[model samples]
Target chain A: MSAFDIYIKSINDVLEELKNSGRRINVFNVPSSCSELPRTIPVNIGGNANPGIILRQDTYVELGNPEAGSSAIMISTNETGLINDGRITLIGPDIPESADKSLPFGQVILIGGASLDDKEHETLQQPGFVGDKIEGYMIRSLPQNIWSRISKDGAAKGFNFECLGKALIYLYKSENPKIESMEIIFITSAKDDVKLLDNISEQVRKISKEITKENWKIKGYDIDCELDCSSCGDKSVCDDIRDVLKSRKKKGLVK
Target chain B: MINIYSQLMSAANKSLFGLTLGPQNESDGPFIMGNGDFFIEIPVAFGCSFSDLTLTGAMGTGLPNAAELIDKGTEVGVESRLCNAIKVATYYLEAGLLKTPDMIITTNSCCDAMDTLGNLLNGYKPWAHIPRFNMHAPHSYDDASYEYMGKQLRQAVKFMEDVTGRKMDMDRLREVCIESNKQCQLLLEFQELKKAKPCPAEPDLAREGAEFKNWSKDRISPQVTEWLEILVKETEKQVKEKKGIEGVDEKIRFLWQDLAGSWASGTVLARLQKELGAVCVMDYVSFGTWTPVDLSSEEAMFTSFGKRFLLEDPMNRQALHTTDLFCNDILQIVKDFSCDAVILPAHIAHRDTNSRIKVVRDMCHEKGIPCLVLGIDIWDKRYMTPDVAFDRMKTFFEISGLL
Candidate 1:
């Protein structure tokens, strides 16, 4: 009946649809205490005492901006346990500390579920949908990148990474029943620390894309080809043969 | 023991071949290069060699490894979301495989990828020594936009001259413009021949395929003019002889949008032709015109060049303007070429054009023209293998009752 409930329901429907379309779905369950966890956190941009979602104008800059280090990484792992369900870790300095400074940013989301499979690779990578679903969170660039903004109103209501991480866990748990545990990690402290995680994150992104491309291949789409047609000399002969085969098919003789 | 004259000629031929392939080294002199989507009219007119970095990377002509270059670019911090073509160009430059241009010229005609790549190139070590000229195309096509583009054209010429130490010879520019206009006329005539019932140009798939493969190399040379003339003559003979592609029954005619996956091994066009009796008689890359320039005077030539680049280059036009053009062109081309359907190759790199697919699809639907959007990456065949593309086309043709 509530807006938040409706949003949760819509996300469930999307996950259900993906499942019905032969994509494996994964959902993890967390302790009921996770939902009741306090939303107040000190992730505000200027160390402000605002609640809910804090608009951190100084916390992070656009990746491509000269001020920003232009480093980004996204990591997802299935190595999880039941106790770690809905657990989020912030390894680096909070937003207030890095305000007005360009620093490396990293995000890691770990999920554990009973039914998770290679087919559900994209399903787990659906955290990008959170930026759109959250009423006041405005992600400036692609969610996979660190360029994001929060509405002043949301920040005043005490918005922080804890709130976002909790919301993600709630959504995933509510949407799919298969997930048994989920954890979100944020690293924005120092460039050296972020760099190590970023290297892994980059590898994860590559593997995820390869998985998606493989899925397309299974569904009958060739994401790429292996032939070097640019240098081929017998192209005309091949074209002639193909033409003849096509003609026979058109005449209903080859089919 | 070769004669000195013979040795000199051989060396010259080798150098010319390297230039045709792409800028081989910094010593190749002040070359002007940019995205292939924009017109290189001014650069060509300035007597400077023009290289389309996107096409060079796509064809893997001079690069040590196109895929590796793309990876290097991503590792160096270019956004992975950027199109592979732009990434490949950036990688090639960063890896020292591509010779840095004396000056980089580009227009905000297509997408943000160009801007990102241009910025990265500007910061790259090789390009830091040179200047990068960025031209902003107006959103609306009018007299004002034409004038603005004309000013940019003149500025670009000056920049080229400044970098190359060459004077802008009005007489030489006019001569090149005349030849370019002649080439455009020949191209238009060739397009007209596609309206024939059997389609005169359908049989020359091999030649067209080769041209698409070596698109970058062939563009600036007189060889393009010769090829166009040969195509015109061949099409004329086909019209006289009433010949189409040898085995094709020509049961269906389709208009291919932008670049098709013709670079792929089996090719989307070849698949459609063979399995469903569909002939892609016209495609955006080959059929689109770069409106003829007037060679009467210096001002007239520059104005014509500006108008062509601003109003005629499809990638440079506004989104709404481009959609309208697509609708109008598809409608007329369908009737003119007797096309039964439209095949819009949704090239992943061309995000700007991909956004207009729904509009084109709806227009075709209203007109009772069946349109199929094939998800393909034109430059990279790995994005859509020939078998996969063929299966999709076969299904679409079967549903449309063209098979």
Candidate 2:
């Protein structure tokens, strides 16, 4: 078999093992034709991802070469309205019906950066959303408990960054994923100025390279978004990216 | 009708009394204040805007000063006392205790603390807080922004009168000013006593003078002034005689990372000087002493006495930015004083420590001087005791030796 086939088979075997052990995993690709649909995956689904396989029981698998658990993988997706709540959308592969009945079906809510305004946050608290939809991929091969243990333990060893990078590659290397361009959006309440947007684009591009190791490139810069200046109009000022607007505008980024 | 001041005073007084009385005492009348022969303690609820804006403004506008506190320095004193005083004054005024004056006069010595306070008070009392400004140092001072501060104070006073039913009584206020100035002069005399070359009085005494002299100015007496005079004279005489702990490597000057003292911490620094052979010659307070105070009129004793009121209360730009410009100034002072080492004994475990460390690191790097940084609450021993942290400090000095 070719290298791509081997990678796909390896992931499928892990899903099978997870089903035998009694847990669930779901995974899906954004359909080629439905690119415009923002992901509507419900958060706090108790499982990592949806539309994927179910693990028959709890299981743990070591990731990365050093035989350390800290090098495990973590996957995240963009969930609709969860941006405010800070819960990214994720889903696992298909699961057996018997395994789903035995184990609780839920998304694993992240501890940090979750916002109350997000749908996942509401679902996690209330366990209900009017029209919940699940999308994206998941891995049942790794147990639910392993996500944090791997991240924290790896962080202690300075391998956390490396592990996270590797996890993203491992999850998306297969399934023939198409390239999606990352767009940097600059929104400000100040007068509409293209130069301001350019400065924001530069900053976003700079930070994007630092965090994603250039794997995520800025596709383009776009204007037409205007965020209300919390501080400019006798309101309490917020200390965020918007704070840099006045400085950046003077540098000729905003016109 | 029982006003908010009465209600708040009762609640706050109960809380304070409960704290002071310990656990066993019965809760009594939480009277905010009582009438005295010459004065009255009218309790009032201070608006939250002062703390919210001033603290935030200091943190933001004062970022430039972070380079200073992390550097080495000699003399240091905490001025949260001044900040607290302003806070109390604001609370009292908001609660209708202190009547809004026709003129809100102040000197220029305070940092962002006063500016923010003046603005916040004016915002709260629009009509009563009108403008009648005073410049602490009309000329020969840096930070020209201070020139406009008097205008802000005047505005605050006018706005205050508009809010409260009190009219400005110029004659009565002039009398109050005279009394207050005399009291402040007496307090200054006591403070001067702490400046003996060898410091005849204990460091703790000097610290108490620093902390409470302005606070208890309203309760001044002949006895208090006399006692202060005697103390100052005695301290001077003792310093001439070299009565205090003397003699260390003259080069062994230490810059405090911040003022590491409660009432108790001052005593500890004094002990460190004696035991560790180091002198603390400059600090945030040294810069603070240069702040302009009220100079409204000669007989405006209230102007003199209330100078502390006009000065930044509880907090000052210098106090907040000890880690900012003061750290760098301190390092230069250390070099000028020919100091040996720098030590930062901040409560590093506290939530505010990361910012403190960042400032300190900037100073150390700028001067290329080694620093001994440790974390421990100077007042409380429960968090991380000084003893446990002292060895780490010693180890740093061991590595770097004397600067």
Candidate 3:
């Protein structure tokens, strides 16, 4: 197996191990498209010669909706499988045309295996390597939006959602055989539809960040502070936290 | 007065044109770009026009929609907490409002935000293909840092020459340094004169001194020198007459800490003088120490420039050193300017300086000086409105009994 495939397999192995530990696994999938792309894409966009997917290519691939402005890719997996949402919706402009306007595109993958203890949570969610497996598509990740581009020639050769989605499914299944079921939704439509997707994605992103933060705290890592310490009024609390963490280190509980 | 205003306008127009249109002229000399705080002597020595990307991006006039320009950065995922000054600069590049420079020279000592902005700008189009020289300003001033920064200055000079096909004239650099020293001396003298009981000069004069230090490259012009001389003479006359800023009673004299209060409008200053008995006699930008350069030695001139870059540049100083300077200045100026209390504007755009606000405040408290830290945005008025800031200032005065 390639390095990318190996990485995905490793993540699946962790999930499988967690599943064996009798923990409930839950996964939620949300799909949205290009209107949200511009908001996430770097403002300094210009001609990039790097090998990735450029959305704006000269081809005719039934890009479903010209007004599809918002897009998101949100994936969340936890110990409880009771919260699984298996809804799959694929609508909007075709792959080729959607690539032309530099529109937003989103894909969310949810995986749930078995519930593991606190120690296994970190291993349960390993960074995925599917981004590199897809040829000629460059993915720029934001909080709620995953903006990507298809190369000019890639679009001409008929790289559409079907191929992209199928590739993702194949990669996930092959890598994480423990993942019992998978759901995929691709939305390519206009204003209100995109907004709905954005709302879901924003919530999912926030939840995912919170989960990651909690995991880090459990693992004895410093929680990220968004505000600068100088201007913050709660410096006393922050200092207390630091002192506790420091004392923990002195006691040799944390590595 | 019209002649001076016309000259200033003419220079501004030339600068604006050079920033937007001049780059399109391929045959013209290569553009040497840096942040606003870069040493002006090196660019002058190489006979290259300096492009301060931050200044051009934030303050460039004739924008159809300033809010839209700033919003462009937000759309690109630049966090709102980052310095608005930097965000606007990034927006200028992203929107193509500011053209790319032929080469980029940046120092990493300003702040994390500026370093990130520099990296983004360097990778952006037009500038993406150009040669970039990155220098690190050490956190502490020492012999090793001096040698290192001085070497970087020399390397920067060489880089400019390589890119622009121009040769550096040591003599010209020496002349620029001498002129810069003269201007510094005049500024220092004016700052001392500000200590008079009834301050002769206003905040506008301090702003003029800041502009002259930031922009003027050649020798201190006769007009500028004469203007400072006139202010000094007039202030001396005021001292003789025992007057205080015309009709105002000068109830409380304030040393506005740092660049935060420097952005207040003339109307704002007027209101403070007319309404609240508070006068901002000194500010961070106007009160920077200008280390005189020894013109006789070329080595000394370059070393002085390096020292200035590492030690003197407000943005480049180490965090602790910066706080120390602020605290020390507050104590010194409280006595020198005979100030009642110090007002720290706590500008949001300046994260590096803002980070030291707590330490400075604590130090002030220990020293028995009332330091009011007002959270404000120095550049983008939209974030913190003038009325809101004015209200806060009034509250501070009331609490401190300055009213």
How accurate locally, in lDDT, is each candidate?
0.56, 0.32, 0.56
Q: What ranking emerges by lDDT with the best candidate at the front?
A: 3, 1, 2
User: Taking the tens digit of each residue's C-alpha lDDT, what string does model 3 give over B1-403?
Assistant: 3434234434534534444334532225566666555787676555556666666555532244656766776777787777666677777777777655678898775566677777777778666778898876676554457667787888888888887677888887877676666666566556655766667656446555545555543224455565555555565565556666665777878877756432364445567877876888877656555556645466656777777777766545433243433444566567546678888877776666666666667657865777888877666667777777788888888888777
State in Å the error of residue B316, model 2: 1.3
Report how far residue A61 has shifted in candidate 1, in Å.
Answer: 65
How do the predictions measure up, each by TM-score? 0.55, 0.36, 0.57
Give the TM-score (vs. native) of candidate 3: 0.57
lDDT digits (tens) for residues A1-255 of candidate 3:
011222233334534544465433333242222222223322212233222222222222322121234454434344324223333434455566554453434444544445323323333333323444555544432112344555555566566665455455455545554544444555544434444454445444345445555654443332343234544688788789889999999999887
What 10-residue stretch in candidate 2 chain B is worst by lDDT? B34-43
Worst 10 residues of 3 chain B by lDDT: B18-27
**Arrange candidates by TM-score, highest first: which order?**
3, 1, 2
Instruction: Quote model 2's iRMS.
Output: 29.3
**lDDT tens digits by residue: candidate 1, B1-403:** 5533233334333443454454443233467767554445455556556676665555552244645656666686777677776777777677787655667776665567776766665567656767777777766555566777777878877777777777887776777666666666555556645656686555333234224323333344566566566666766777667777666777888777765432642466777776667787776645444445756567756677677776555455423143444455666566545678888888786766676666667667866999999878766666777678878877888899987
Interface RMSD (Å), every candidate: 21.3, 29.3, 24.5
Q: Candidate 2 on A102-174: residue-level lDDT in tens?
A: 1212222221121222222222222111111212212211111111112222223332212222223222222
